[model samples]
Target: MTQVGEGQEAEESAPPVMTFGAPTAGEILAERYELVEHINNDSAGRLVWRGVDVVLRRPVAVVLRYPGGDSATEMLQAAVAASRVIHPNLVGVYDAIDEDDRAYVVREWVDGQSLREQVAAEGPLDPARATAVGNAVASALAAVHATGMVHGNVHPGTAMISDEGRVVLADARTDGADSQENDVRAVGGILYFALTGHWPHHEAPLHGATAGHGRAAIPDAVRDGSGAIAAPRQVRAGVPAYLDDLTMDLLDPEIAPPSSDVLAAELARLDIPADDHFLESAGTLRFTAEPEDDRSPLAAAGGRKVAIGIAGLLAVALVGLLIGISIFGGDDKDPARKPVAQPSPTAPAVEDTTPAAAAVRKLDITDVKIIDPDSRVRDELDDADKVTDGSLDEGWDTQSYNSAKFGNFKKGMGVWIDLGAPHTVKSVQAVVSAGGATAQLFAGQGNFPHTSSGDKQLVKNYQPVGDALEQYDGTTMTFSNGFNADQKYRYLMLWITELPQKEDGSGKYKIGVQEITVQGS
Candidate 1:
């Protein structure tokens, strides 16, 4: 009955509509997540929404992409990969659902602004604050890279600062197009943006960043006529020289950026005290780039060795400064000051009595396996790598039993560790989820078979290093002094005899090993 002109007018006057299959507020995906509000479309054309998980009764951020199946494979895969890594500085991914027509990822909802937004709104942050943010990002990247995964997206937009002042890195693309080196370089870009309110376009492109000059658009790094980008210190006052050098060195493609853990350690050292003023001295910590040829052999050998080398250098510098201060700190003219005591030149040179301490370094764990002998199913044997994955949040847990003695099924289960080669073991530290669990450290030689019979044989052959930790009262158990420091051990075992009772009222007993670190040289 309606006329054609009238129908056209009604369509024009109606509110703007979302594209078909697009999600809306109050709409529930997978019947558990209820979308609260649509935040915005990300650079990759995915819709970001602030939602709530009705089952958990917690707020969550939902990223939705239309036409799922083959189109949303990358997003789904990245989400799945990211979920395996559990770190405090990383946004926790809860679930990824593929509904054929659409795919959505649910993650922890951060109640704060992105670094880019904060910098744009409040200009540049002080060097101290920027360093803290950079430290958090680097730490997150270290955890990610430990799993051989790359967080392809590391721009300011992905660096989120929560309302509680916690800095977390979010939205890992893992698209395979980027390298770990690129991820490290992007941290430099983040620092540059945080210090100068400009994105380093030449070093790393900021995803979803506009090109224009407005506040909403992230401006490119200021450069000279020679096309070289200016350092952060030149752009802003109060930026520390060391921090400037570190940032520029990271941005420079010619120089290889330090590994994520090394960078994280350096940044952690440089992180200023909360009570200290930003403009004040940054203390004795300094980061300097050394020439390739002049670098120490330990520094050239990457991993924890590099960190140790850098720390050793800093320690030496600090010792020198302390000695100088002691020698020339007081004025001789001050009569109130006490005269320093000097050893007599004629006195016999005292014999150096202190014993040389054995060097303690983190031993490389080449292989790890669960030694479960009783259970035929071997349900708890899969996550053996989690203990050494460098993440405390993810761990290998034993199955719950009615009794602490594993329901009297067998004597106990243990985790075998291979050090790859013979090394002098100084100590073995095991971080457990709970206390009151009975455990012991055992040392064995040769390969230990991964079978029920082999497990029994291992228990019989392996000699106990220390007395059994009967009802250990702390979370971390360190077996030291028990190991023969002069002797080299290649294989070790952490055998857990009793499990801790769960806090839940279920009366079930289980134990989780969060981390196992061996220190030796």
Candidate 2:
């Protein structure tokens, strides 16, 4: 009888116990939605979870702050206010629940990553594409501003692009203290970051915007003594003039920020048109380089005039020849044979002699810092100098993750070198540890603080040195038209967008950097 009673008690306690203030997977919230998985944690310590609305049978994201207390008061208020306004670009709020012990806000789930992730992985977007992203955010802000509300949190981290090519702005922190002007200016910051890979405003507390020491990792347009920052064209090589003017105006405090509506209208005009399907897969806008033979209208007209002049001279010479033929004899014997011009054998062609330049000595990168864009552990890894210390056995390696796809967590990773000062680099050579890894060489002006690989635009004055790296064994990336005076750069970022398998073949992947050598004048 005692043994049978003990077995019954064990069977009764077989189910798992639910913890207070903490929700687990498959748990139902408000008895209407089921939590699927934990997505991420925001800066405010709120848990963002992927959930399903059992009643409506739709997917949702639930941002919950445990031990509700007064911590969720602000989140609840912001959700209520955002619910009042309706915009396609705005994330829809499904429901807000305040359980005294735990508070959760259920909202529409976005099927995409943040703009910060996109830029970090793919580098900067083309001018037209960057303008399109700016325009979408501006349009959304115009609506929010119209409601007498402000999107206090408007940065690359909050800007989202859907898999269907729809642009949406998420996470509006409605504190009522941040002004509409600040929101408008943030749109300019987005354009600046999109163009230069650096945040323009120093006041905005954005992730990866500040350094580990708590200083502005990326500087704004205004220089300390200089007062104002240079135009986008001055920072970047291919920025259009009109776009540069608009971005500078918004960033400059002297020039008042344009109304969200007005700014949106102007950006729309500059944006390139694309079908929804094309924009969806392309992710960024595409622009083609103009061919050398393609000329402007004025140049084409001048060429036509030169051709007409030559045709007139040829016609006159033909008429004179006809007159001479009619007056002269028509017989073949009477016609004089013309001799072709030829050079005498004694007059030898002058042979030109010019020695080709010898390759520059390998640069010393020992003083340079190694930057990782998609690092999960530490931004500046331990013993980073090993990569430049000329040691193959000991070098920089990435943190090991579960899956080959970075655990399907972050975008990608890379390593960069700041030369301390600008140099006319002719070519770059790197010895990577992993095989089948894809790397790209990017050049930029080291005018701002770049905390991580996400600082793609901070190199405000930057350009791609060459195509994505090819032939990875001590790959040599020679800048096109080597040493064209305009190619001087202080920073060189070798971003590895893809990861190769670990040497042990555990079906997991990470990257390793052995040595980096830059040959420049």
Candidate 3:
């Protein structure tokens, strides 16, 4: 990614203007796509238009560029590459065509505005919403990277939020300059922009702004006297410390950014109701440095000796520290050396000095309900309460399906739990009948009605606490370090997205939750 001024200086003193005939609103391209309305011209001089696919009878977006022979090669390549990846968070590419005069690419038409437009219209989003956006973008990038392709273009304008609250990444550029690492870092930039309403990476040009031409539509990030960009917490109030640390670490060149999948998982873990103040027991972000090469001759000789010397010193220090603790800080008394003193009966009894918050105990679940939105019969509703009945032999189970994803009939099913009152949660552990099922933990406020419509609304309202356990291999799954210690949760949901194969070789998919235990203060 080149800086704005540097990019401008590299261009010709007076660049020639290339022309491709203008397209009319009613004109049809490739005899299949009918243009509806013109959207906008991008910084790279491509025209974007909303169109209709006559054959498919659906809305589409067409991107046109001039001089199709060689100038449009990269654009066409990117479109073809993007078409191969099918993900909910990625804008679907339909077709790419090259005419003698121009080339055009048609993709899915989104009904909502871009991130840049949304931020400009309203203000910065809350921390929870900003985290959701980041998670979506990272998930899209992970899908693209898995196919061994790089999305050279990733910015606020390329990220779109539809009217139905679906976030999609669009307009990939195959310029051969951007790397997978750059795509992952751009997600951090997205978070910064969503939380602070400012773009942190000035080197990457925005959608409508050409580098070195003029100021971008979005404002640059604020910096201190030392020329260091301010963190999200510094720019805005109420940003969580863990989120702030994760955002700044992603932007820092000194710290190695996590892979797209790793970053997506971390963001998913942070996308919860108590995200504003929740802190992970371990550090928010864990970065591992490249291991040193021990094959070198110098390392084999001097490194070994140095490592031995350090180990010897550490061992001696450990012994000395233990002896000092026993002599000066030991809590037990030596009964042989000194007689023990008895307590007076008149003296008041000493109360338990342990803090209540430090202890982890099983929380009483007031109620449990089956959340099966797609099933009209509600076959398994009766056994919902059995999940907390202190028995593992009999519990709730979903109907067996031919496929892992509920036979493509619905999204998922879940068991919703309501604690008697708000409590600081420590962990949630679920014991299933078999392995290979995928599930996630969610937290929210208030319970919805037990109807189908209410179940749909419940799914929408409850935010995920951590990443889904993708194809878990064991019988027990535990979600820990995903809650805020300062915040209490009254409602929780364990949504199962994918089911495991039945053990009896029935050639069907289903899973049963034998028991669910929650530990809290």
Candidate 4:
């Protein structure tokens, strides 16, 4: 449950209890319609059901549940309030009522899979794909924001990518009425995960410019910028420099302090040259009385999103159930799900395309290019002798969390710190295992906050791709795209994963923190 603003109802520590009654399918709501299947649930523990308007025989979703006390009542009330504003991207509320100490609030059902599934199977998505996802959800955000409501919980896991390629956001204006920025921050989080195939905060923090600098540029509450970030090209090849630069720009709130709608519009504008008609805009979003017959945003098969009633969602409800790790990975013990392979030496490195800030210094180790080198990948390591036996002392920290779930050092495991105050950090660098042959950096988080860490963006001014540290271990590369002279840091955190035995030639998994140097003004 999220914390609401002044006017909204407060969250209750104890939620309501719901029991699935043996109500036969076709049972009508308040003896009105024929009940169908269960859809979803509300705060009041009411079970929503699909039903047929027995009188009219039209499809409808009905809400019925065992209610909690004040908290449950308030949640139901909030849903009723949200029912006032209707948007294409938002779920529509039908009605609410209390019966037998159970309060039920009905809403439109949506047909789609959580973004969580897509990311889990495909790993970090491409920038264009990510933008597409973000744009769809951003439209929803725009509508919610216009209504003075914030989708307090917005992320890949929460956003439903319908079969129609449209993203629908749930839990809008539910029990929480947090600040609008909370949704903005959430957008930032989802964007990070989409690109990096991981959460933002699951990884580690970078030695940033200065806490004051990060604060000065970004909103005060968002302090998840891990100092070091990876450039996008490091992960895959053929990525246009323009797309890379755009993602990096969004990472820094100061770079382009625009709203999601504004940025989304910009992306839509980019799509004009290629295919203008596909662009989503107020004109294209024609909402007719019945959304079923409409076909927009093409998908291969289950690509269309059909808005149903509250009962529809319950059929595929994943309430109160979280997988081993978040789609945007979190800081949990690595449950080495599978084995990953080490990156090949011949893997070509992409040219760094990160833009430079006139006011800051740039740190580029171009002369000392890193491909398949030994411990120290410095300018002096040009010779083969130094590459092999260069390391002085090192330690290994391998987590035996869950062997079946979290694969070897991918997106989930990394370094992290809970910041206390502000500090000035210069640079952050580390070396992860190249990886084994079985698994990949699929579970890896962006260097900043790890990929899926919601509410935890690291290195305040870095992108999820190489713009910020996006990859860890081998089979992928991650590092600070550029280090400026005047860096900022308030609190610093670090996330690291151990190189498995197969990846590093030995099982003694460990992350090498060569050094974390701090610079002060």
Q: What lDDT tens digits, residue by residue, belong to model 3 across residues 25-67?
A: 9999999999998776656666778899999999888878776
Task: Write the residue-wise lDDT of candidate 4 on 245-333 in tens digits.
Answer: 55454454444234555544544433334443321221211111223445553321112213322335764465423333344354445
Candidate 3 stretches with Cα past 4 Å from truth are 1-17, 207-216, 275-521
User: Which 10-residue window of candidate 1 scores lowest in summed lDDT?
Assistant: 1-10
By summed lDDT, which 10 consecutive residues of candidate 2 come out lowest? 1-10
Question: Which parts of model 4 are misplaced by more than 4 Å?
Answer: 1-16, 20-24, 39-49, 53-65, 121-126, 174-177, 201-257, 271-521
User: Between the candidate structures 1 and 3, which one is better when assessed by lDDT?
Assistant: 3
Q: What is the lDDT of residue 319 in candidate 3?
A: 100
Candidate 2 wrong stretches, greater than 4 Å? 1-20, 207-228, 272-521
Q: What order do candidates take by lDDT, descending? A: 3, 1, 2, 4
In model 1, the Cα lDDT at residue 156 comes to 76
Would you list the clashing residue pairs of candidate 1? none
Model 2 TM = 0.47
Q: Judging by TM-score, tell me the better candidate of 1 and 3.
A: 3
Cα RMSD of predicted structure 2: 23.9
> TM-score of each candidate?
0.50, 0.47, 0.52, 0.42
